[model samples]
Target: MTTLFSTMPSAVAPAPAADQAVQDSSPSLPEMLIAWSARDEALTARSARLPGVAYWLREVAAARTEHERALVRVVNQHGWPSVDLVGDEAATAALRILLHGQDHAFLLRCRDLIAAAVEDGACSQVHLAYVVDWCLVRLAQPQLYATAINPALGRPYPVADPDGLDTRRNEMCLPPLAQELARHQTRRLAS
Candidate 1:
């Protein structure tokens, strides 16, 4: 039952290089968010051909960027009161439509996964790591998770790396983002 007010662990400061990786050579956040929305609709139309997990994944790919923007928006717009307002279904739906999907069943599955993780004594930090893994598997981001979550934190956080998740730059299934993320991971590992 994590709400917007739930204490999220401290966000790791991005390294300047990682910041450059993010800030350089990407579409505007709004553009990425809108593209994600379109991707979700496309997935929904193709749901019958995709696995439940894959459908679930199409939604995650759609929404990852906007989730961050929405958080920034909530804080900038309403401050503390925004926490109370942020977790509302409508707000969640808007964000999910950007990252995941609008399907109620898919949202329920996400809720269940989060609840199960908490019941397993996974703190928000660890739980987020699990989410990153989940998203990586679904989003097919591969090594992006390793670069995004610092291992020193005991458990990784669930945050996705925006540097790698550009839906528009690529015309079809995952090659561009995958190649870009792989290159980014190689650089991170070499460093």
Candidate 2:
């Protein structure tokens, strides 16, 4: 299975120190990577039970473009309500276009899917993360939460309408992802 964990950075945060503590000890990009890698085992276990999704994953891996493979991997890893609920082959194809093809209208579609799939709790967090990740990638950015400090401090950002959301250009309201990226940049600048 594609498993959401795979798309995460390979090096996550380090163990907490006995003497060091804070209210928000957010993981750095490297730390996030580590955590993501460790979760690979979880994805492996989950993949075994979802065969159809597995088949799509293989196809995605075999696809000609990086974007196609990335989309397939993402869907496999984070998709919810099961592949059956994602709809028939047509819906899957549409999802592929929305995700990989960089179709913005499809983001709302993906969100709708998420809303239906995840009622609440941890699964919802994962689903939203996936959607946010998709948006970040489409904008040629990095994964969310890797450098995030306070995710709860903001209003929800707006996504472009896919059908009307132009593919010829990039939109705005990427502040959330931008904040994370800026923190990483600032750290590098300081060093």
Best by lDDT: 2
Cα lDDT of all candidates, in order?
0.38, 0.40
Q: State every prediction's TM-score relative to the real structure.
A: 0.21, 0.25
Q: lDDT tens digits, residues 75-141, model 2? A: 4444532333333332333333344343465575566666565454313333455466566655656
Using TM-score, give the best candidate's number: 2
Q: Which portions of model 2 miss their true places by more than 4 Å?
A: 1-101, 120-124, 136-144, 147-191
Worst 10 residues of 1 by lDDT: 12-21
lDDT of 1 by residue, 41-107 (tens): 4444445345575634544443343443443343233331111232333333334442343334343
Model 1, position 57: C-alpha lDDT score: 53
Could you tell me the lDDT of residue 64 within candidate 2? 18
TM-score of 1: 0.21
TM-score of predicted model 2? 0.25
Candidate 1 Cα misplacement greater than 4 A, ranges: 1-27, 49-94, 98-191
**Deviation in angstroms for 29 in model 2?**
35
